[model samples]
Target: MALNNTYGARLVQQETALGAGVQILLLALLGSATGMGPAGWLTGLVFAVASWAVLSRAVHRSRLSSFGPANRVTLGRATLVGGVTALVADSFRGSPPVTLFVALTAVALVLDGVDGKVARRTGTSSALGARFDMEVDAFLILVLSVYVSAELGPWVLLIGGMRYAFVAAARVWPWLTAPLPPSTARKAVAAVQGVFLLVAASGVLPVMADAGVVAVALALLLWSFGRDVLWLWRQSRVVRQQGAGRVLESVAG
Candidate 1:
């Protein structure tokens, strides 16, 4: 067991505090340089600081560092995604904002693998870590989907919708909440969907690129969802059979 010493915590806390201060200072500088003025810059600064604080707290409370290399990578990745999203939004203006957001989003989307790979390599896999990573990925997907919807229409929801629907299904069907083994294919599909949405957002792609990518993403999502649903169904059936067997044995006794 690890000692309860605050050594590691202090190191992280110091870094996090410094980061928050830098965000505020940078936002102030940007406000002064650009006429976005005090209000916009202050608002951006507040959001940046708040987001960093919350994520730091989450990492601490969850003791995610104990989770090993892959999970550490995942944590870094999610933080990076959230940071890049906010930075891109604040830094860009006018027609080019879309292009900038697209490029960063693509990088963030691809970097998703770093954490999971580290976790698997280090053998630090845990349910909490996996769920944490999944939730972060889901939120980014939702953010991108909503942004695209303004120009691309509701069909963009398909990318985001499946995730929410799965969460809802888990709530409604307890069996669906049961954990199954992870898959590389599922992760690849997620990356595909993310790339598709970001590409569509850039508007640099041809209609065919948008349509083709979206179709592939939707297909992957369908395959993933179908596999999970089936696995859940099988688990439920096995559990029911076990229960029935116990009752029969008791009655016979």
Candidate 2:
């Protein structure tokens, strides 16, 4: 048992170190390609360090025996995201090459589908893997929104900020923490946020058309979230009423 535990620890450390190494390599490439400024370099460093620390802690807590193949795909996607993030941050100083930015984001989005399939095929899916995947997706959307917001109005941030806002609200209203039933519509809505943002960022469409695309994405996201919130609220009320009835019956007895 001690040998097994030690081996697991070593494996986790190696995988995380590999990930950090990839991040550094990516940052170096970006700096050379785009002349990324201090802000971009700093942001990328912070992302790499934070990802290493948090993933290490989470893996330790979960007691994963190995880093797992599916997670490796997700880690690659995260590295791409780190590159996209640095580009966006550097954009404030000067515009990054749109082609480079779009390529990284596009590959990251494509691999989003690939990782889940890999997880299912390998039968290695876990709650931690799903959450990690979701978080990477969410942060990519958030970064894309920030980039687009520079061109569109700040209102564009609503698309990226909405999920985070929901998470924060759940802390205040515990009912919001209830698990939602799987819905295809919800998944589709979540998936499109990145696509639409990517399209807008690519500058392929006319300004008006890009704005329309983003607006539609935001509206769909709003509807999906609203439906889930309503469902959770109704379920919470049902539970409360059942509790109340049980109390009344006990009193009568």
Candidate 3:
């Protein structure tokens, strides 16, 4: 077990290094093409380091023998997300190269489904992997939201911030953390967030049309979250009722 744990830690360290290296290379290339500034580099560095820290901690806690193929795919996706984040941050200082930003985000979104399939095929799925995948997706949406919000108005941020807000709620309402049954509709809603945001960021559509699409995305996300919250609330109520019944029976006995 100790050997296995050590191996996992080492593998995570190596992957983290590789991710950081990729981040640097991509940022350099982007700088050459688009003329990035200190803010861009700084943002990318923060994301790279943060991802590395989180992933390393997860790997340590997981204590697996290997990083696994699914994680590799996720790591690659994260690298793309870092690139997108840098581009988005840089946009605050100056106009970003639209094509590059779209390309990076598009590839990351495309690969989002691939990692799950890989995990299933390889039978390497774990809580850590799932959480890592989810956080990456959420961060990407948040970054894209920031980029799109510049044009569509700050209301678009709700689409990105909703997940984090839900997590925060879960802390106070532990019942909100209950697992939800699978729903294809929920998955579809999540998948479209990046696509819609990317389209908005592309500036290819009419302003009104872009806003309409983002509005739809936000609506679907809200519905999905609301549905889950309702389910969790019901489940919590049932649990409380059952517990009360058991207590009353014991008291009568």
Best by lDDT: 2
Rank ordering of all candidates by lDDT, starting from the highest: 2, 3, 1
Q: In lDDT terms, how accurate is model 2?
A: 0.94
Model 2 is weakest, by summed lDDT over 10 consecutive residues, at 58-67
- Estimate, for each residue in 1-253, the C-alpha lDDT of model 2 and write its tens digit: 9899889978977898899899989999999988999999999999999988988888888888888899999999999999999999999988899999999999999999999999999999998899889999999999999999999989999999999999999999999998999888998999999999999999999989999999999999999999999999999999999999999999999
Q: Say which prediction, candidate 1 or candidate 3, comes out ahead on lDDT.
A: 3
Error of 3 at 205 (Å): 0.3
**Candidate 2 residue 201 C-alpha distance from true site, Å:** 0.3
lDDT of 3 by residue, 1-253 (tens): 7887787678777876888788878888988989899899899989888888888877777775677899899999999999999998899988798888889989999999999999999999988889989999999999999989998899999999999999999899999988899999899999999999999888899999999999999998999989989989999999999999999999999
In the predicted model 2, the residue pairs found to clash are none
lDDT of 1 at 196: 77
Residue 8 in model 2: shift from native, Å?
A: 1.2
Off by over 4 Å in 1: 1-4, 10-57, 60-76, 87-99, 121-128
Give me the displacement of residue 110 in model 3, in angstroms: 0.2
- Give the whole-model CA lDDT for all candidates, comma-separated: 0.67, 0.94, 0.90
TM-score, candidate 2, is 0.97
Candidate 3, lDDT over the whole model: 0.90
Spell out the clash pairs found in candidate 3.
Answer: none
Candidate 2's displacement at residue 200, Å, is 0.1
